[model samples]
Target: MSDNVSDGVSSFADLGLGPELLNALSGLGYEEPTPIQREAIPPLLEGRDLIGQAATGTGKTAAFALPLLQGLSSDEGRTGPAALILVPTRELAVQVSQAFHRYGRGLGVRVVPIYGGQPIGWQMKALERGVDVVVATPGRALDHIGRGTLRPQEIKAVVLDEADEMLDMGFAEDIEEILRETPDDRRTVLFSATLPPRIKGLTGRYLRDPVQIQIGREEAPPGEAPLVRQNAYVVARAHKPAALGRLLDVEAPTAAIVFCRTREEVDQLTETLNGRGYRAEALHGGMSQDQRDRVMGRLRGGTAELLIATDVAARGLDVEQLTHVVNYNVPSAPESYVHRIGRVGRAGREGVAITLAEPREHRMLKTIERVTKQRITVEKVPTVADLRARRLELTRAALQESLMEDDLSRFLAVVEPLTEEFDVMEVALAAVKMAYESSGAAADEEEIPQIAPKAADREGRDRRGAGARRDRRGGTPAQGMTRLFIGLGRSAAVRPQDLVGAIAGESKLSGRDIGAIEIADRFSLVEVPESAAEQVIKALRRTTIKGRKPTIRRERDTTGRRPR
Candidate 1:
């Protein structure tokens, strides 16, 4: 039994919350309930189970945490936690626990975070002292359950935060086992950024008579900037590094995350950005837990301005100062793009989502736009002129600030000597030039070739059409390249973008490097450099194309001849 409720309430008091919780919210400066909070808190306070479909920054934590706090009881006989919240990562577990502490301060709710990468004995000591709430990762929670350190019989409410992420991380069985240990009548709540089929299945099996609430991006009133300003730049593959640096110069983000497809890309891009005078840190599965913690610490402490990470490594991370999300390449899936962008534009703060797309990936940008239903404004890569002008503007701003706030008496001696030798205006100009040069002037700028919008669309059409004809007649492969036959084609709803996205996303090649693509009714043929043919074949074999692993091999000669 599930119901979808839609209504609006103006304030926390309007939602029937107690004074302690309401005061805590007010102290935290929470102005009003976000849509998810307004929709979820009432039913949750009434002790109804819920399924909340909201992104990371939409106040979902408080939506669930507030209700749990409202229902807190002081039953001395209860030996186990009154509520259990399961999160996907240790970082999120700590964050959720902190939220609970902040909201439940007046109520004296004892909350402890249990997760791996921390000594189990410390967590055991906390549990032994008794707690009202336990926030943990699924694996650690199960370990406690197995050791009898965690007693679930008294839990009145259970929360599976980021439920979809847990499933993706292979925690389904553990979640189920932990839930089975809890009382069946407990209030079960599930929150996810996405409601995939697996999540739906988990909900059906666990949550009872849940109230389903779905919240999308908030709509800013007409004539206002949207929460996230999405923009994409189409440029040639060779010039992407320069284009990205130029755009960053113009945007001047306080903190940003550049998402890459693989660990290698993350590492390489991190190095490149750092060399270009940006404070960057790389995060991927290849890093140890300690290394990851240090990187995160640096970012949170405002020491690192940029994080270059793969999708998997960046999931469930919420950074307070993140003002921009950069897609090093367009994500292969629209869902991924949504998740990546959702990290910013949080709590009414404006954020930006920028993408650097090669001309060949222009179509993927359109596909993403259509799916997310948000227009990605296609703009020219910032020119070298734009970069220089932005740098100068920054320098002027810095000088203006120093003039207004700094003690300039010490520099007066040098300026007085210069003014005596030259005109005042010329001395001033010389001083400005020195300041600007010291402030990291642009080095050896070059103009990046720009793509006309219509030209890119035409290029896509031309390549798809010509490649299909070339493959049908067994035409010679492009210079230094060979064609590989893929089993699924137009009939499988495969498009040129799909083939290109799969190859570029799964393998080391960029979309621009993947040559002509030919899609027939039953199969497809794509051209790759002769040297990369075997590598692409193995990479494709290991991954799925159009949700199926198609037969991938070199296209035969017109005479049905085999390779020597």
Candidate 2:
């Protein structure tokens, strides 16, 4: 991949966008083009397929979208969709569809988002009405194609957004099938944060002599702050909720997303945060599409300040006001960590990424650090004294702003009377105290216990080098992990990636958290952390594996006995 810059280009107009799209960008307050946009637009506008390696929040949506919108046939007689966009999640599908509408409104362009959670009838109706573009998840798109509701014979262009994530969710087969159904001459574009072997294989097969582009995280022009501040805190599992609360108090973000590992954790944490007086909502795969939409509306409408969610449910979400991203626990994998933190630090705005790690997970944090090639400064949890000081500082700043910008003449009567009855300083102090109290400045008195890195965990990691230590048979469970039994295996076309993808996509556990796998003729065994066993089982049971719902449960102990 080539990291090339468009020299001497600054504005969207410089990149050759039509007046309609340029007017939309100007109305949306976009003054300039992001790096990816400047580089990708020209080539894509020329009908050249491209492979772009850029992180989320890099304005890649507009990069490919503008070209597709500009290339739309101006003829009103067009019947089927001309361009197709495949995203990994329903949320993203909606977001991309909205973007298309905003950019192409002057053109009267029609767009539709197809996904599983939402009713299919709505999508079918949209298709019947004739759309210029279709944004969909792979499985749902494949289903529509099979039902003869979506015709791809006339498709001119296709964009695969977040291709790596789609593959991770076990949508590889579905994606390939959908692409094969489309016209062979269709222009294809792929965007991913990271390029693994599988992604390369797909590009080799599908993207014909594509223009390659790589946009790394931009560095701060000398002496300024980086776009994103990365940091972490060490606390025991029991204190994670309290520690998170304390951090939020000190940070006082305008809007934030707290990432959790499972639906149960997300629910519990949401309740605790709301009880602590923060407007928090939970999002997970277990929630219905309507529920998910409502939660997102609350967040965007400023009615909710925090969104506690699982990785799967939170994918493809872009919130402009989000200022901080908190990890309730260390991410199970480095790629997952990268994806989580990418939600913030977008469009040149500075943001923060904070992680709360247990002592045992300290090593995992280090692994993430090495992979991202960035330092995750481990800071001590904010103390009660710190919280008080921060709150007081906030109160002082508010009063100062009011004095400078607000009309205080109406309150002169009260101030004059107080001055006559008491010292001005005393009256000021009392007013400040009232303001602090009214702002809910009282800090939690209970201090979260500070945890140090565990030496034993470090030593064990040093001994084993980088990878997880597994037994000779590759089936022995690790410490605190248990084996799970699945009735569908090799005979059912089940593979390790399928199991890992199913678990990670369904639950909060990342692929890294899933341990060894042994695929027998009619059964399969995998290891997951004991704490997450039940969640995994429930998730697997609720969903299908390779189109079959297999018996999933904790493996029975059979060491001393033979098969009956």
**Inter-residue clash pairs, candidate 2:** none
The worst-scoring run of ten residues by lDDT in candidate 1 lies at: 465-474
Please report the candidate that would top lDDT against the real structure: 2
> CA lDDT, every prediction?
0.81, 0.83
TM-score of 1: 0.76
Q: After superposition, how far is residue 321 of candidate 1 from its true place, in Å?
A: 1.3
lDDT of 1 by residue, 401-481 (tens): 355446999988888888888999998788788877776774737888888776655554444423222221124566677
Each prediction's total of clashing residue pairs, residues at least 3 apart in sequence or on different chains, is 0, 0
lDDT of 2 by residue, 382-473 (tens): 88887787567546545543553469999999999999999999999999999988877764888877775456544533554222332112
Candidate 2: where is the Cα deviation over 4 Å? 3-5, 26-29, 74-77, 395-443, 452-564
